[model samples]
Target: MAIAAASTSSFPHLNHTLFPKCPSLSHHYHFRPLRVPFTVRASSAVVLERDSITQPQVTSKVELFACPVCFEPLIRKGPPGFNLPAIYRSGFKCATCNKTYSSKNIYLDLTITAGTKDYTESQPARTELFRSPLVSFLYERGWRQNFNRSGFPGPDEEFNMAQEFFKPSEGGVLVDVSCGSGLFSRKFAKSGTYSKVVALDFSENMLRQCYDFIKNDDTILATNLALVRADVSRLPFASGSIDAVHAGAALHCWPSPSNAIAEINRILRSGGVFVGTTFLRVSSTTPEILRPFIRQRVSQSYSYFTQEEIEDLCSTCGLINYTSKVQQSFIMFTAQKP
Candidate 1:
């Protein structure tokens, strides 16, 4: 990675007073004046002055981002000029739509569903089922208990396989799709495997809880962890930009699994890995006693895949080297973009 030298004229005059270094987090951060005021673009470079000897070199990650609506690279909206650091921690408006998203407590808001018919006209029950405060509470609090009783993959093996599957990449950006309550996303951030981990969920309440869960934690810093509210079907990332992607126990909830998987493949780099676990449809071969519970879970699910169905789905999405493991009613799988 090349550090964009501050001498370039493409950067804006950064107001250092307004954008002070975040001291509370204890992470290496700094800012310097941009020589040439410029908007964020594919050719744009983020230049920051070194505030300390220990501060890591600045590199451009904006190229990894895109407008969900248009698939165009997003430009940051600054008062007079924009700084990438400011865009990361505080907030920045989208240059295209002038929509503002903030990182309140380091939780990045990426959803554009507000004021749309789907949000305003949808029944309260439909929306609340996923984004309600109460549902988020249950997911954050009682989900573990529910999992234990539901005969899903236990946390131990689930996380172990996640670590194993994603163990290849040492650093770079990794996205956690539908990261409910930020459980594994925060865990992966704490482990220091990736330079950054994006915790993306559709529910604002879920992301709010996710921010609360890690706001005070020392190991998980804003530099490495970002909570983004986004739909899995239409990911807001640049093509072939993401290093890896992961989702856990949330695939069944997707409205269109095929579209979501296609989007996942679209964002991942050619060699990037995609790993996740989800509910598998129970069959007649399953024990009679477990059928009712499985059916109950599947009833709420948009769709459930058997092992063969999932493998075929991955293949259709252009992911190769597919591998799957069945544990109880859960299916764990890993594949890579070829």
Candidate 2:
């Protein structure tokens, strides 16, 4: 990518302390000093210097995040690198919408209603339950373990299965949609399989809980991982920019599964992969008589889908190569963007 160099006057918010002072130029005639900026671009880092005499200040430009409202690339100001600390200190702004998004506590808020104060909306019970602070704290501690009763196979096995499905997307960007408490996001980042991993969710407390688990782990913190607050139905990414999307046990909780899946397809590249896990309404072992009752009861809270329905949904959303593995109520499915 070409690096566009411009005068510091354009970005008035840039801290002068971040750069070094230029050497004095002495001449016979008295004239106004010209402040020229030099930028050195690299694959991993970008350095900006005010003058040749001073040391260049290294900073990283954020290009992965986009405006949730306008679907435009966000401009970033502040520190370099993709680490947690660098991202925390950075601020993102959308040029098209003239909207600014900043880090709330630790995670960046990129939702359409991120800055809204008077307009409060409530999500369905299934989505709002995870937003509670208490529930967010217990998600990985004990809540997720309950899935074993329904044949979840545990997190270690699930992570391995997802990894196998995501092999084609190696060295690419991965987004963990609805990543409550980031149980799988940390693993994906540590594996070094993807160039970057985004842990995205709508719950504020869930993101805070994710940061709590990551703050003490230097190994995972140093990876190219980002925590963002965004709605699943309206993903914040440019068209065909994402390589892989993983929603572990999250599809059933979405307000609208069709809208969410379509949004996922919109963000994925032509050959990108999407892997997700959710609870099926009724497994093969379920009694024929009880199937209807189970479906009715679950439909009141979460939108559990049958295996066939899931395949149909993926196909309808422009995804191909549909396949799945089922064990009792638990199901892991995969689809590719064509």
Each prediction's TM-score versus the true structure: 0.75, 0.84
The all-Cα superposition gives candidate 1 an RMSD in Å to the true structure of 6.5
- What Cα-based lDDT does every candidate model obtain? 0.65, 0.81
Number of the predicted model whose lDDT against the real structure is largest: 2
Candidate 1 lDDT trough over 10 residues, lowest sum: 5-14
Cα lDDT for residue 187, candidate 2: 94
Residues 172-213 of candidate 2: C-alpha lDDT, one tens digit per residue: 999999999999999999999999999999999999999889
What is the RMSD of candidate 2?
Answer: 8.6
Task: Give the per-residue lDDT of model 1 (tens digit) for 8-125.
Answer: 2322322322243445432533223223333333245322323335444343445345667766555443322122234443334345564444443344555556325545524224
CA lDDT of 146 in candidate 1?
76
- Which regions of candidate 1 are displaced past 4 Å? 1-63, 77-89, 93-100, 104-106, 114-128, 283-297
Error of 2 at 130 (Å): 0.7
